[model samples]
Every structure is written in C-alpha cells, then in structure tokens.
Target: MSDEPDETPRLDVPVGMFEDIEDLKSQLAQLTALVEARTGGDSAETVEAVSADEEEPAGGDAEGEEEEWQYPPFILLLDPPEYDDELRGLIEWVEGVLVPGYLGEPSADAKWCHRWFEHSVAIARLHAAWLAWQELTNPVSCGNTGPSVWHRDHLDPALRELRGAAGPFAGCTKGEHRVEHRLPSLVPSAWTHEDGA
Candidate 1:
C-alpha cells in the first residue's frame, strides 16, 4: 500500500441519508403538532422531551396536574363511543394496509370474511393483534427484529385463528359472505324463561 496521499476525493456517506433524516424530522414535527392539539398546549413539550431514559421527578406528579396515558387502552376496555372510533381506525388499517400487504392470494384453505366486523371473535382478535403491531413496529423504541417478532408472535396466530377452517369465519367464502356465523351457547339464558327468572 503506497502512502502517497491519495487524491481520489472519496465520498464516505451513503446516498439518500439526508432525505431519510428529513423524513424523520417531518414525522417528529407532525407528532409534536398532534400532541399539542391533544393536550391543548399544556403538555406540548412532553412530546419533544419523550425518551426511553427520561425519569419522573421524585415528588411525583405536579400539583393540579394529572398524568396522561401515553396510548389508548385496549379496544375491548374502551367505552361505546371510544370503541366505535377505535374500531373505525382499526378497520381502516386492516382493510387499506394489512389485508392488501400481508394477506396472500385468497383460497379455500385460507378464507377471509369481507364482513369481518360482524364477527366479535374476529374483532377482538384483530384488535389485540393491531395493538401489538403498533407497539412492536415503533422504530424509535423497537429494534430491527421488532417487525419479525410482531409477525411471528402476534400476526400469524391471529390470522390462523381468523382464517383457518372451524375458526371464526367458518362458513365464510370468497364468493359469498356468511352473516349468521354464531357461537354455540353452552348455558341456557335465564331471561328467556320470563318472570325475571
């Protein structure tokens, strides 16, 4: 190796790095704005200050200040109005993103219910899976294997249950949607007997 002060004008940085950084900055800005709107300018700074290593004060929460929940609670735990709203968003993601991207070519072996919302079991399962996906796919806190973990641990099982024969969509077919897929009731209903029995 000759030590003759090479003048090749080498470029060290990878291409499109600045663009990626700019995109991240844009996302952060949008998130900050959303936080501002949600908190009504009270805890706007909290978004910018958010970090994995950040610690709360020793004195606990400040006087007259309530601590905020970072994310929405489980969909099942939400009240009617909140449940409706969250369900709408979840439907958007499931229909617009998840099905189109992850769901392979449809067949008799792997069935998908077009009217999936009608199935309570499917709703609960998909909501849980979606929540896991949101947490696992967050780039800031999650490692590179986050998506893989989500797919293996959360998504696959949910899909298997929803699409497999004898699953939630047992009678559903690609050509036709079955609206009356009902769960068997093991216990007799007391109200059905009348006289408040």
Candidate 2:
C-alpha cells in the first residue's frame, strides 16, 4: 500500500445522491464556475518539459542554445527529496492527466487514477458547497427544501480536459476502490439538451 497522505484535496461543499432539480442546477453552475476558474480560463500549460531529454538544458543555451519564454508563476505542487524525479513527474502528470483534462481538452487518455482523483475532489467540493448553501439559503432545513443538491456538469469540463490529454482511460470501469464512489460519469454526450433541433 502506498502511504500517500490522502493524495487528494477535500471538497468545500456537501452533496446529495438525490437532490432537488433547482438545487441540482445550482450545483451544476457552481461546478462550472469553479472548474472555469481552476482551468486557467482557457489557456493551457505546455508539454515541453515532459518530452525533454536530459542533455536538453532547461532551455537552449550556448550554455547549450535558445530563446526564452516566460510563464506566470503559481504555487508549486510537490516538495519532496528528489526535485527532479518526483517533482517533474508530478508536473507532467498534472499537465497530462489532471490539468489538461479540467481545462476542457476534448480527449481521454489520462490514466484512471488521475480521473478518479480529480472527480473525487470535485464531488467533495460540491458536497461542501451544498452544506454551506443550505446553511445560508435554507437554514433549519425547512419543510420543502431539505438540503440543496449537486450537479454533475460542474465536473464535466475537468474530465474533458483529462480526456484531451491522455485519451479514454482503459480501467475506468473497474469498481474496487474508495475513489470509485465519487466519480461522476464522463459522458458529455448524455447531457445534451433536447429540442431535436
């Protein structure tokens, strides 16, 4: 067993298996906004580092060779012993599986664990939000509005992003892990609106 300390982040909202329709819509909207925010608003992280060779200096320099391209800074993800081995792999994984997937990429090659981890995080967030929304909107859990519900759309973009990076994950159907309980279906086609037009 890998003693990864929860290798996942907790969601900030509560969720329900069967939520009211309006509340469900609300949850969907929330998911949409959150995903849109996390995905860096449509731009994507590049894939250069993942494919780079050892002799290929961080950049081309006569000191090896080339021009410089700058990227904005953000918090780094890992902080372990081997910065190169552990860190670069994570950056690539995030770039490949998690980041690309959430940013609305339209493929599906991200591995199963990647898909599973991202979905679970979103679910946890939805549930957390549901809890908070309930407190503010329907305090006391009055007669008609027990607890607000969650929508799956909010989580769809991330899956799409992952799909674009990797492609359809093969073991996605297996159901023998804790994370499986939290995955939202990745079938975007199934939610298309009707009018037959």
After superposing candidate 2, which stretches have Cα over 4 Å from the reference? 1-61, 64-158, 161-166, 175-197
Per-residue CA lDDT of candidate 2, range 19-123, in tens? 676677776655444444445444332123223434465646653342222121111322344424543444454556445644443223543443443443433
List of clashing residue pairs for candidate 1: none
Assess each prediction's global lDDT (C-alpha) against the native: 0.77, 0.41
TM-score of 2: 0.18
Per-candidate TM vs. native?
0.58, 0.18
Q: Positional deviation of 86 in candidate 2, in angstroms?
A: 7.0
Stretches of model 1 off by over 4 angstroms after superposition: 1-72, 185-197
Evaluate residue 10 in candidate 1 and report its C-alpha lDDT on the 0 to 100 scale.
Answer: 85
Best model number under lDDT: 1
Deviation of model 1 at 132, angstroms: 1.3
Q: How many residue pairs clash (N, CA or C atoms closer than 3 angstroms) in each of the candidate models, in the order given?
A: 0, 28
